[model samples]
Target chain A: MSAPAVAYPDHLRARVDDYLRTLRFPSRAPRTDGLEDAMRYSLLAGGKRIRPVLALATAEAAGVDAPDVLALAASLELIHTYSLIHDDLPAMDDDDLRRGRPTCHVKFGEDVAILAGDALYAEAFQHLLTAQPGEPARLLAAARELAAATGVDGMVGGQFLDVAGVSDTPEDLRRLHALKTGRLIGASVVCVLLLAGVDDEAVVRWRGFAGELGVLFQIVDDILDVTGTDEGLGKPQGSDERHGKRTYVTEYGLQGARSMAAECHRAARDTLSVVAPAGATELEQITDFIFTRTS
Target chain B: MSAPAVAYPDHLRARVDDYLRTLRFPSRAPRTDGLEDAMRYSLLAGGKRIRPVLALATAEAAGVDAPDVLALAASLELIHTYSLIHDDLPAMDDDDLRRGRPTCHVKFGEDVAILAGDALYAEAFQHLLTAQPGEPARLLAAARELAAATGVDGMVGGQFLDVAGVSDTPEDLRRLHALKTGRLIGASVVCVLLLAGVDDEAVVRWRGFAGELGVLFQIVDDILDVTGTDEGLGKPQGSDERHGKRTYVTEYGLQGARSMAAECHRAARDTLSVVAPAGATELEQITDFIFTRTS
Candidate 1:
């Protein structure tokens, strides 16, 4: 299942940004009007492109040209972006702002926002179909991974449980955030593996890395919500407390949660050294990006 | 591409009903409590199971046993049922009842109903993973077909266009419904073709058959909505007129719409005759069932 090291060469920042700007989503209906506009509003609105960069880096680390998986890589961001849109729905989180801009529902209206999210979800899978016929097996594997990550067991289920306010304790909070925040990030890594033709044993090791990274990502987010200000967040700070939701910070206290985040981030870097290629510094950088981002 | 006269043996009524009763959805989330129940409420609360039976009958007509594509066939129903649940949302059609029972949002809260629809949509694709691993190409082919059909160029695009009320005349209506209603129905036929390992030429012919069948199904729906009673529809009649949405029935009078439905039925039956095997009578019967059934 292992492969000889071919160090990842590129940063992937430029390549991922270029792909998102250029890729044309396949739409046959003629009256696209504002549908495309609504989708692009959030999709292209600039959120650091962390998810796709993770996928692209993973592909590059596995000794494949990241551009070959560019469409597949960008799809992770689309799914992530769509989840954010749906989560901001008036009926859901009721968030009126995100990414330093108006939320999708606020910008495009709730109906269009919902439809945009649904469109993005379906298009994420549809875009993968453009993978060349020679890569059918790997393509199928990636698509399946994406679905399982975003579907009921992952993002959707996590949102459902979160909105129902079903958690009672720290363990419940850990389990909830693991599914809610963890799965798609895990999927982004797995998409890279399958697309790069990595083996299941290697995939298992990378999943361990992604699991730690995902929790680290969420914990940092909770830390940001508590410590950052509206000027930095583009929304009010202390939102978790406002909603009376128990995040990692709330459960662990500021100092304890910071330690937990650091521990998880360290575990991820350690695992990366094992699963990644020799001199695969890009992945480690991305791990730090998820761990240290303030907004 | 022409198949001989093999009739679609067995009514498929009992088999499809039995399969729907017994098939287990692939859901991993533990706190399924209300989400699963809402999905089942609309799903198991019976309709004719028309779409799935089409896939099965198509499989059977191609000379394989129907159960071979059971997962694929059942997936079509899941998708169809999910679309119905979404369509009946208060922000959408706002129907209170369906099939003589409460609509999902009416029975469940709007939030849960939305979640249920989202769950069903994801589960539809997840269920396809159960298809034969031995036939990776066919399985991938089926999944891709479903995704494309319900995706931007197909169902999702159609729904967006519909809600925006983009149609100006009859041709616009046909184009709208072709995407909205046609693609999934078309995917049902394509599923049977790929699963049967049929060639491309046969697939084209069956797609034509499905195109006609999809329109026939919709025209019949509009007519039933205009003329049927609450006892038959399980919801208030005159929904299309109440909404003032354009339809075949609205675009053409009742007599004209009925003739259009019959014409579509004949065209579908005619195309099926060329595409079906020597004794494929069951498909013709199903076509008639779609046409003549009042409910």
Candidate 2:
């Protein structure tokens, strides 16, 4: 049985929503055309701004001002948005629905959609460079984290492996998830740690915690695809099974997958316990909330 | 008529060729998945290697050692290669031929091509970080320059404008080329200035000179696409015209475009005259070489 839904503090939820709103592209002149529209449509489409929220919340939990973390948070959102746009392309996942609306390609032409995604991905760094006046070193560090997590050795590499073939073992599923979904989510938390000037030991602990949390999140996502209604998922259900895509739950029986998820949550909690510095009550609450998300 | 072809210095040409060969990915075991083969194929499908050559030659002209500039030079090639891969994708330019060979997507499957391009782009930063043991700050600056040139306000943005409409006026075409092809090439020259630790005033002047040279180079390319023979051009001539793409040669007639190209080249030479320090004969050679290229 799952734990009851945790009531996220209203203030934090509102903050995330507001940030998402601010991320939309400013409207260009009438003749400027569909590129900006496609970018805004996908970026501003309602989804749980979880990754950016994690970055912001983690930074705040580490005692940095929330505004100081805003640009980094936005950069995370841009990376996430780019991935979604690309994944939904005709050459890739080719999905019609994303966040309960037509995907970027479905709404705009394929060529425009591709360019929009590329623009957003590039704009992420442009925004970072100009976002807030900070140490150039810190800004570069943030840019590196964003690039490394999204580029070849991170999410893209995992996608390649997933498309090529999955290893037959359950352990292979774990390793794949550790790269595909885990790295970027892990980077979100780590970005906050670096921004807050956390010690190396604490960063390691936080990254480990986030890694486990990411795996748990992926497993939960797989489970939801199998069991949840279309309305609940905001997209088609059973996509993993339909596509014959290898997933954690596919390798492990339902009961086994559930048990593994529980283990991951426990490991995550344990790692978080090690990393949470003094006065980290909010961080603890956020971890608890992660364990309770249903979709 | 174009100016007579100036003989390029034998040593510089040989060094560039050697650098290109050494930069090819080794087809060793554990990496024999054929992805490296695809990357190597594209990297070796030689164009002028203008960008990397500019980087290395500028550094040398600024009195920086060749060894210190190798990684930076190679990083520019990696970026150029990655951009070519994406530009040739079905959704983008859809060109079957690049540099007289089947484009990356034609030789490699689209999925592998996408991943290969991604790997090259990511490897660019990895190479910069690891290859040169120079000041970390310099490495970071180089990476940032590359990123800015490729990002939204740069090449990506220009591509966006290109695909979104041909409704652009002559002025819009100029702006688009400045970003699309000009930015990265400009960044290539700027990287050497920054790496050589040139004074701010000198760096500023070189950047302006490089930007003008890039625009001049692109305008000449547009003219060549329309006027040059298929044998000389490698790819089919007038492909851009067939696509209804608005180019300088499209907006202005052939004669007008040729005159504009010459004017741009002259302006570029003037800028270089102001920026190139004493004893920089190689820089003058590059200016002449740009004007004489048939393809």
Candidate 3:
């Protein structure tokens, strides 16, 4: 009924993987003593690659070539990977496994893991600034977008709220999700729009789509945490519950959360309709993928 | 003999302090639940504004206005502050104090401390890209310089070596300090040159000076770690010994390390003589400060 969730663009993800794989870290000395290995281990650790795939799809929907946005799109994965490494530290979520392997800190020692995360965070900005193909002004704008979304007001701030146990109310829970997860997801889309120099009106419309997509993504993540397997999720299932962290599912029951996801999907589709309908097939497919993903 | 250390430019440091003081972090919601407080707490905790002051001094030495480079200069301090926060984490150095106050993790809890550090890292790039007045290309190049010095090849990589206990030999220790402390210090000068668009030849000469400055700075740091007081350092003195870490002083002994610092100071002066001599006074003053500072 909902166009039978099109398969995640495995072909596109493969391309992204190849690009990431070919990249080399520059070191003052010829070797970084496996610091790069810690970074690569987590970066190449298999995930859905949903954030980057979203950036690529958004590029298409915005009438920009996917190749043109590949590096910028991939930079988001770097930030996401760094966050995972830090978030898994003993002091935070204390995750022991990630993507079916020992967590970064568990494998590399806590110090290397911390340094690896810091390196990746710096590399994300470097890659976006140096590798992305665009006008410098536009690239700067894109960099600023990425920075704003990752900073205290966005992902890190949201993380603070989550760790502080301050997001008790449903309203607070929504704010937490928006800041922690939603902002970076939105930036993945917005950065492409900025690079493309989209008109302000079009930006506003696409932002609406991005906003809904972020909401839908987080809700699905919460649902999967409840309805997933440890193997399938590539980490422990029930972590949210184990941590007693408030989630959409905790605020709204399971069925209610599903309803919210469905609502977001419809809203995303409706917002896409407001833009020119020329290259939106991939975006719609991604929306379907987000709604129906099991893990 | 060395002009009495020129008072370490407290007036310029005060300007950097005021600039950093007035920076208002943007948030989607009105409040970030003290995440900014955690960031501000460490950022304002006070260190000798050495890196930013180096940047400002470099700008002046290159015949550029300090105000033009102030934001970029201040950005270096942000990176320095973030590195300190992470370094003091329980999983890292496990320190309780920084700048005479409780370490970020000690004050804010580990999770908040980690997020605050991450936030500061993002904000460093954000502040540089948005606030520094320059051509976009030049600004992007400046950003890249900061990134290179902060990432795997530079500070973080150096930290990795230190934590891994790999720098056993004098040569490896030199490499470690160069990467860990020297690169960021060098970048404080290099970034200003990039933004100023100095000639390549001038860049090479300035880089030589910066390199010597970095070496001299680290040796002095090592000396202070041994001879300094806890009250003087605002953190525990003799931490390198307590941690069983290798340092210039550990390798060379206190007197030998002091001689090396003096040698680097001489080299820094010789390198500056290769460049235009009209604007070399502040740099010479800074070189003397590095050579003589006890804390």
Candidate 4:
């Protein structure tokens, strides 16, 4: 019977899309220059909304209602979207396709794309500060975590190392992914923990799970780059190798990388089993999906 | 006696520089990739430290000690520095020189420069959230104001309009500058008001003065771009005209722009006189310096 045919929380994603569609700018320019349109172009473009989904799942696992942290969750997607826009710039990964459409820079021109990314970054913090439902301290703490994960020592630092050429050793590649992609993914969960006032013991366990999930996600991504087709991936396959960038698949053989991903998946599920075994069904499903996603 | 010698607030600038130099990252990657150095290279390169100085001066005018708001004040400079790095990119203004040295992209490569700018943007919020001294509500308010001013309707929107080619009319030019340079400059003062718990009446007055000061600063900058030398301005003069960009001098003519700057200076001083007559000596001096600055 196909295991009763459950779904991956498209309802939560729809809620996010609704809130984002109705987002009202506190101020706007008298002259229109397509900045807002450009921002919404990539932001509203279809993706899995994985970061925000992670945030909502973390909230659910912690026994908080999803709507209570919806804005916080959506803010992660803003940061993620901004990173994608900037990453696709000609000077960076230089890809022309995202989500089966022209990349932000390709569609809107480079200057607008850069500004759109920047505006989204600023909007992420603004929306978190203004729209989140929490006490001031909790909100501030969440903002701090988001900023730290997005900053120099996190995603930006990781990208720098990647562009500058890491040594392709497992350690360097791990560090690169941990910074470039892992920190923000970890933050998506940790931010919910901060907002929900989760206890420290569970927080630590969740942190471990989040770290493992991040590694797992990156490893699966690397594997799919080798195995997936362009139509399935929504981007050109093997572009990573073309750019001479290091990945887990490059550092370790494909089978080796898949083994590592499976190990991480195991560690994550085990950690979750100990922490929120009763409430983390969605988190478990999401983990399985991330590990096995074809795209 | 040559009018008792006094200087601009080099002491406050020194304080900001010291705080910035000692900033500690909460997390870091195992590999170093020149991102930190790129951020520092642009941030520490001197440009009169006007934005932070404005913040500190606002704090002083409100009868608050500068050290209490030093981190908040310095955060503005970080945002300003990030904007400059991004603005000087080859896809943007395409400038190679800034503050009498190679631009961030020229010094650190384009990819590193982009990441450095991104890192600085993230760092600005992180520093404000973690390092700024205030109650949670107050700090959150300051952060919201900062983020709003730096986002789409503010600096980023203004830059978008500028790059996309405004109509070069006086209204369009005014709107562009108001968004691009004016919003963040205004936020520098208003952030202090929020942090210090200043009343609404005084906040409105300060906002007006800040608006005038921003216009004055941009007018003087436009004048200098037309009139100053490479050595004096620390960047190539006439580059705006060479790029076919419109400025205050282009829209209003040199004499007309100068007159407008003088009017703004007078309006700013008048606004300050009504609100902070006794405590705003530094504010008055800075206003004069901005109106008359050669660079």
- Winner on lDDT (2 vs 4): 4
Let me know the DockQ for model 2.
Answer: 0.37
How much of the real interface does each model capture, measured as fnat? 0.46, 0.31, 0.83, 0.85
Model 3 spans with C-alpha error above 4 angstroms: A1-5, B1-6
Q: Which stretches of candidate 4 lie over 4 Å from their true place?
A: A1-7, A24-26, B1-7, B24-27
Choose 1 or 4, whichever is better by DockQ. 4
lDDT of 3 by residue, A1-295 (tens): 2235567787778878888888777686655858999999999998878888888888877778899999997899999999999889988899999888999999999888988999999888878877899998999899999998999878888888888888767888888888888899899989999999998788888888888988999999999999989987889999999998988888898999999999999998998877746647778878889888877
TM-score for each candidate, following the candidate numbering: 0.93, 0.91, 0.97, 0.96
Q: Kindly provide the TM-score obtained by chain B of candidate 3 when compared with the true chain B.
A: 0.96
Ranked by DockQ, the better of candidates 2 and 3 is 3
Model 2 per-residue lDDT tens digits across residues B1-295:
3666675554665676687688644211122246567777888787777887787778777888776788877878888898888888898888888888899989877867776776677667656655755564565666667777876657766777777764467767777777778888898888777766677888888888888888788878888898788877777899898878998787888788778878877887788777764656766677667766777
For all the models shown, what interface RMSD does each have?
2.0, 4.5, 1.3, 1.8
Judged by whole-model lDDT over C-alpha atoms, candidate 3 comes out at: 0.87
Docking class of 4: medium
**DockQ, per-model, please?**
0.49, 0.37, 0.78, 0.72
Per-chain TM-score, chain A, candidate 3: 0.96
- What DockQ class does candidate 1 belong to? acceptable
For candidate 4, the TM-score of chain A alone relative to the native chain A: 0.95
Indicate whether candidate 1 or candidate 3 has the larger TM-score.
3
